[model samples]
Structure formats: structure tokens, C-alpha cells
Target chain A: MQYIWINGNSDQGVSPDNRALAFGDGLFETMRLSGDCISHDQLHLHRLMDGCRRLNIPFSQATAESDFKLALAVVESSAHKFWRLKYIVSRGATDTGYFCDNTVVPERIMLLEPFTRDVVSLQQHGVSVIPCRWRLSHQPALAGMKHLNRLDQVMARQEWSSSDIFEGLTADSEGNWIEGTMSNLFVVDKTGCVITPRLDNCGVAGVMRHVVMNTLCPKLGLLVEEKNISTFESADEIFLTNSLIGIVPVTRLADKTYKIGQITRGLQRALNTKESGL
Target chain B: MQYIWINGNSDQGVSPDNRALAFGDGLFETMRLSGDCISHDQLHLHRLMDGCRRLNIPFSQATAESDFKLALAVVESSAHKFWRLKYIVSRGATDTGYFCDNTVVPERIMLLEPFTRDVVSLQQHGVSVIPCRWRLSHQPALAGMKHLNRLDQVMARQEWSSSDIFEGLTADSEGNWIEGTMSNLFVVDKTGCVITPRLDNCGVAGVMRHVVMNTLCPKLGLLVEEKNISTFESADEIFLTNSLIGIVPVTRLADKTYKIGQITRGLQRALNTKESGL
Candidate 1:
């Protein structure tokens, strides 16, 4: 009845020598488990595999599938019924510095926790965000991969703590819009075109961001483009997306206000239909 | 009796919920131990304290002094002599996301290992290095701190594994020189002005680099400059520095060759006089 599982066992704690703890040599996926379904699991697995390939951690597709199944079984057996699952893959434990040894086995740790985000309230009456002074660093090698080197996001989150502020939008060093501290952002221009910042330089390519860009927007016939977005002042509408909160529109950013436009409502409906409780 | 200590105790392993494993919300200092001495103790402590302030992790001066004293005591009690000690300060363990809670108690894990390096041969013959395809990311927020988000360094280390190659030179995305994979880089030009890449934008500010810049070069009355160094073709000498390796000169880089210059030899002598078996 344990909610934590490390390498398919619930008894083992994390090793002090784990490369994740040592050098952040790992990847992680935060997925929403609603009822019995994990939302957009294929996309999560795809990104995880891509991260593994980039870091050379040797996480095979078969191993990911097997681990996912184990995670599913553990979630189903939970007595308290968990909602959020953080699946992590570390480059195991090693005393070596900066060297990714080929002989090292990857360690997977899955933790399920009870989560209750008031999605309906937030979606209906959007969320207020602030502009963070903290900017993201551009590393094309590690960009867009949801790896564990997230000190940037951690720093960005410290920018705002007001109860009214739902998130803080962080930009790159050049002032180009990157993403929210915990979610992906979308900007709708006056031409009714949806735009998200290009993640080739920084920011995570979130699972739900992929869903909106590839599925919901296409289903609604709305044109979405990915580019370097700098100003949000002229944006007709704005919204944030992540696995936990499917699509929460932004109503206020600093002093500027944005209407929860037609596109946002449309995407919200589409996401609701796709992910029931999300 | 133990070579490892986590918060003054040796029995506890790292918690699975550690933010270091979760988001790399941590800082670490690797210091060299010879007999009863830890090399450049004040510099390492200063860096660690500065890192805590930057990350907003509440660590008191009294606590750091206490932990350091405890670390020294553990080393003295060890039957197996330890040469290398890695002092880690994680943002502790939490199930929460990006927003760092201020009340969180930072976890300190100190690991001591028996490390051996043939310093004389490498310092005399010098080591060969190659230019890395992997580049460092520019983050003003994290520049110069020896934090745990070292995936850039981890990836850079994998670029060359030829036993003959000791390190790789990693530049920033704009092709400006940053640092070596594991050590700081210094290039002595034709006019005898020693230049090292500025770490204001990126790269770890190593303790040895600080010692060389602030102490050794001044002692020799040598002209040392910190700026953007792109080409090494016109360099008279080159060297690498870290807590573990101290000052090891570079004899070969890619196709070009360099001699172990008089400055390197002088600095080596100064360092030896200062730190006896370091």
C-alpha cells in the first residue's frame, strides 16, 4: 500500500551516490492519473526517451514500457487513491565526477501523491501571473528536454508568492518569452493566430503543450505557430498549459489584462473532453 | 568509522524526496584533503555560503562552521585515509514543486573517498585536450556558482574518452571560451599576459582558479587578465585548474602544441609550497 516505488521496489530509499543527487544526471515526467488513465502517456514516454538519448542514459523503450506498467499497478493498488505521479530515471549511483559511465544502470523512482488543483475555478476565472526578473539560460543541448536541471524554474518560482498570483512568466536572457515557472504559455495574436515560444533555446516542451499544438488547435482549425515571442502586451488572449492543469487561461499579467478569448474557451472544452478530470 | 556523513550522522541515506534528485536544488564543493588539512578552506566555504544566499536556502554561519567542524572530526576518525571530500548542501526533501519554502531545512551530505592522481607526470608532461561540441548555457542567475545543475559539464565530459585526452574546452553558444569540462582554463599569450575566460555569464568559478588568480600570479608578479578568449593559436602556454587537480598545464590542444611554460612551473612551485602533497 506504499505510494513510493524505486526500481520496482517500495522499500529502497534513494542512494546518496545517485548521479541525480550528485549532478542532476536524470529525467522526470510529471503525469496526471485520473481515475485509471494517465493522460497523454505516449507523449510523455516519447519525450523521456528523447531526453535519455540526449543524455546517453541507456533507457530503452521496452524498459520504459515495463516501468510504466509497474507504475500503473502501484497507482491502482493505492488505498488513498493518488492523482499525481512523478516518474524519475537517474543514471544510478556513482562516485565519478561528470562522467556518464556506460556500465551504470538507470534507476527509476515512481512516487504517487494526492493532488487537488481547482481546475474548474481556475479555468472559469483564469489565473493572474507576474513577470519574473529571473531569466532562463539558453542551452540547445539540454533545451526542451524535461531533464532534472531545473534550478532555473526553481529560481523563477521564487519571484512571486502572492495568493492571487498563480504563476510567474520567465523569459530568456534576451527578454524573449520562455514559459511559466510550472507550465507552458500560449499567446493569441490579434489575427486569431496562436503562438508559443520556441523551446530550442530554453524551457520544457510540456506534454499538454504538445496536445494543444498538435491535437486541440488542429481539431478546432486554429493556426498555431512556434517562434520567439517577446511582448505579451498586444496579445489578444493568453493561457497556460501543463499535465496537472490541462489549459488554464491567463486573465492578468502584471498590470496588463487579457480576456479569456474564444480560442482559450475552445481549447479548454476540447481538453476537458479529452481528459475528464484534468 | 564511516567515510560519509549526512547532517552529522552516517547511517542515513538520501531521501527519495530530495530536491537535489528532483530539481537539482543544491550546491556542492569538492575539496582536497592532505593529512589534516583541507586546501583553500575559506574560499570553498565562502562559495558555499554565497550559493545559499543566491538560492535563498537558509543556512546560518554558525551551522556551516559546525558542519565543517563535524566533517573534520569524521575524517580524523576514519581508519581509511580519505583524500577527496565532496560537501553537498541540498534544499532538503519536499514533495512540492518549484516554489521553495523558506522554512525548509537544507540537507548536508559529506562524502569522503580515497582519490589518487599522478600529479607529477601530468604537471611535467602536461595533458592533451580537445574542443568540445557541447557548449555551456548563459545564465546570469547561476553564473560562477558550483551548483548541482551540471548536465552541461556531464555532457561535455563524454565528448572525449581517449585515455590520452585529459579534458575538453567548452565554449558558450556564441563561440566565446568558457572553461574546461572539469577545470578552469587559462591561456598565456605571446606577450606573456595570462588570460582566463570570464565566468560572469557561465562556468563554475573553481577554488583553484581563484587561488591562482588572487594568490599565485600576484606572488610571481605575472600579468593575468580575465576576458573573452576565443583563439588559442597565439597562446604561449595553457593550463587547467580545479580543487582536485590544482594546476596542470596543457601540452597539446587539438592539433596545436604548447610547452609547459615558466609561469606554470612557478605557480606549481608556489602551490606546492603553500599546499604540501596537494
Candidate 2:
């Protein structure tokens, strides 16, 4: 495939010694693009900068904005109308191990490529999810930052080799439902309030989850609580969300099944309204 | 910072989109090198391969052997005489995100530089230890392998902002002592048996810990058990181990004080003997 590198101002290969490669010392954002414009642009960048700050990595929003423009330029140059943008800021390689001399500045690399939303499957019918046996490690400091340490999710997703399973739901070490493999999980109670797992300590606080929490909760007159969610067995309706796929309705889990219920459909319509309005 | 890269045939920079950076999808070995030879090369390779197999990443001992030779070449090319060797095998980027179309071939990068062990002040006089407030997430499938999702260690290391504190001791979600920031911890009881936390579903199975476990326990007829170790306040003597720093003695933990006892010195001598033998 075609790609672009942001470091050299021209597309070139990266050194293997990048700290991002060595110790996974970096943060990244995967977003869906429409033509050259990314949906939810400002919010994505906001989360990215928040991640950088949490990790003690610095980011100049002005530079990042220009970099995004250049990244889109690369995608447009590739003649692809829509694609994904992955932004990475890595502490440049130092001597041998994790201990650096604290003199090297981090390298920021951005790439643009063709990506079409999986609209056909997600639109025609909802996805199926399994509560994975894997439990996320909780270190409150690193939780929700979306740093590069994702091997836990990789292993969790590998639990089933089936193509039919769309996403796997993970829990914290305390057995509380957290999120899906690459998305955030949301469930609507019978009282018509939306409930999502609090991600202050573990799982990624997805941008879509944030949007729903920040924008939709008050407007829709629904309560949103970021608290420890009990067993899914007790949930009335289940759904998932991510930037790439605005919102996905979870239809089945184990022997239990959920129809696209009223509250979930309403939330989807609300998100779509916001997206189209933007 | 001198570096070396070995893919299939050529040694170049790693791919920009390598899964290593994307997902921490790799395994690495940090080894001590003296006079251009790795001290227990066989054991290091064994642990590396074991990690690869556990993670479903491929491993070729021959490629690793050549990589070590190349690392030696880089050391010879540099001014420093002694250094540490970091061998990393990450799935090169072919597709986006965690899943790939097929298994991406491993990207091997080695770096060698002047190896400086931890400050002698800590090792000689012993260093203060704080019981980490963070707990290792219980992840059985991903446990024990040196896969790169080390956000836990990053948080643990960052818990202390002062240089006065040398290290932080962490535990699993179950409250058993897992390890230190970058080293495996061992405790000596009044009976002279050495005890280390088992690496069943948490903590790294350090290579040096393995060497001492095999040679020292059998050779010196010392009882070495891999069981759940409690907080340092209860242990008589505690020491840390890694490939880079062979053994570092721990002195104080809250109300408890441990002398740099005879058993710790014996273990250090044994480790030095193995390195010199290599």
C-alpha cells in the first residue's frame, strides 16, 4: 500500500531504533476520514494531546494542525478520497535500554492511507460480541491514555479464531465490564439512561464514547454514569462505539440476544444527527 | 546511540508501520555483553524463543545468532568496550491495527552501547524500596512473556519523582509481589533459601533469574522456590536481578531493614563467575 511519513517532510522509511519500536514508547490515534477531512477532527486531536500530556510527551497543537493538513495532502496525492490517519510521537532512540540521557527529542510521524468504513456489515446488521476471558490490568496512571502497550488486547482478541465474532468485551482485573477490543461498550437500562464503563483506570476512553458522554447525555435527557458496570447478563440493551465506526449495535452475546432496542436506536440517530450536522 | 537491524538479508531501519509500534506486538531480550560475548547466550535465546512461541511470533535461532554477531560487530565498530544487547522481534507492518492479513515477518533490531550498571551506591549500601501502590493486572495468557506492553512498569517507575528512591516493588492484582521496575526481585529467608515470585500469570520470567535458579540452586544446593512472595517488610533479605545488572541488594523497606547478607553475596559471586566463564 501507499503511505506518507511526516518526519522528513517527504515519505521515507523509519529507523528500527525508534523508541516506539523498541519499548513501544508512543501514543497513536486511528481515525476515519471523509475525502480529506477527518470526522470529529478537533476532538480526536484533543484526546491525542491529552494522551501526550498524560505520558509526559509534549505536543504543539499548531504543529499538529499543520501536520494534519500535510497528512491530508499526502492522502489526496495518493488519489484516495477517504482513508485512515495514524499519528505517532516516539521518543527517538537513545543508547541501549529504556534509560535515555534525557537529551533526545521525540520523533513525530504521521501516515495517511486509504480506508473505507465497514459500512455494509455494520449498517445492514449489527455485530456480535463475546465477553472475553481476558481482564485488563489496572494502573490508574496509565489507564485511558491509549499508549502503545496493547498486547493485552491483542491476546484477548485472539481468544476466538472465528470470523463471525465481531468484537470481544474485556473486563478489569476486578471483573467489571470495561470495553471491547477496539471500541467502547455502552448499554442502555430499562429506565432509558445510558450506562458506560468508567475508564478512569483501565480501557481506552474512546473518542466516540467521550462524544456520547459529553454531548448526548444532557441533550437527550438521559443519565450517563461512568461507574463499575455489573454483569452483562443484567443489561437491557448493549452497543459499542469508536471513531472509525461511529456506533455499533451489539446484537448477541453467548446464548443471549439483543434486538436493536429503542434507546440504542435513539442514541444512534442522535450521533448521526451530530455527524451530519458537522 | 549505535544500532543494527537484521530482517531477512539486509540490515536497515524498521518499517514505519511495524506492529511493534502499533501494538507492542513483539518480544525483546536485554542481555549483558562483555568482551563481545553474551554471558549465558543459550539461556537468553531460550527465554526469547519461549516468549516468541507464547506470543505466536516466529523465532529463528540462526537469525538471532547472526544478529548477536552483528551486534558484536557494532560494538567493535564503537569506542565502548562493554555494552548491553537488545534483540527485538516485532511483526513488520503489512496491514493496519492489531490483526494482519497474515503473520508479518519479524523485524530484528540490535543496539549496543557502553553498558553502565546501576549506581554502586544502591548495590553496595542497599537501596530503599517502596511497596508500589499499583498492581499488575492478572493476565495469564500474556503473563511471564517479555511482550512489550509495559505500561505497568512505566507507571510503577513514575510513581516516585525523587532520585532518592532507587526502585519500586510491584504486585499482582492478587497482592503477591511480582517484581521491581526493571528487575526481578528475590528474597532470602533465615534458612538461606532464595525465594522469588512465580511468573505464572504475571511478571516477567527473567533470564538471569533463570540462570541463578538452575546453576545456583543445584550447584550450591540452595533451596530456591518460585512461590508467591509477600511485601518486603516481611522478608529477611531482598535483592533484584536482571540481565543488565546481575544482582542488586535491597536494604530498607518501610520499617524493615535487610543487611547485604552472605547469601546475596554468594549469588552475586556465582553470577559474576558465570559471566567471566562466558
Judged by DockQ, which candidate is best? 1
Looking at model 1, residue A55 earns an lDDT score of 91
Off by over 4 Å in 2: A75-81, A100-103, A160-162, A234-236, B8-12, B72-81, B114-135, B159-168, B173-176, B251-258
What are the clashing pairs of model 2? A16-B14, A83-A115
lDDT tens string, model 1, B1-278? Answer: 22777886775577878898899999999987766667788899899999999999887757766766766765676664437888889988876588767788998888877666777678778999999989898887799999999899888898877788899999988898889988999988888888899988899998999999999999989899899988877789899999988899999899988899988889899998998765
**Top-lDDT candidate index:** 1
lDDT of each: 0.86, 0.76
What is the model-wide C-alpha lDDT for candidate 1?
Answer: 0.86
Q: Can you tell me which runs of candidate 1 are displaced by over 4 Å?
A: A77-82, B77-82
DockQ (Cα-based) per candidate? 0.78, 0.51
Give the distance in Å from residue B63's predicted Cα in candidate 1 to where it truly belongs. Answer: 2.7
lDDT tens digits, residues A1-278, model 2? 55667463765666766778777777888877765577888888888888878766655667677778876766666665567888887766655444544466777777777776565368347888888887887667678877888887876877776878888889987789999889999988787778999886689988889888988777788888887886875678888998877777889987689888877777777887776522
Residue A130, model 1, lDDT: 96
Alpha-carbon deviation at B94 in model 1, angstroms:
1.8
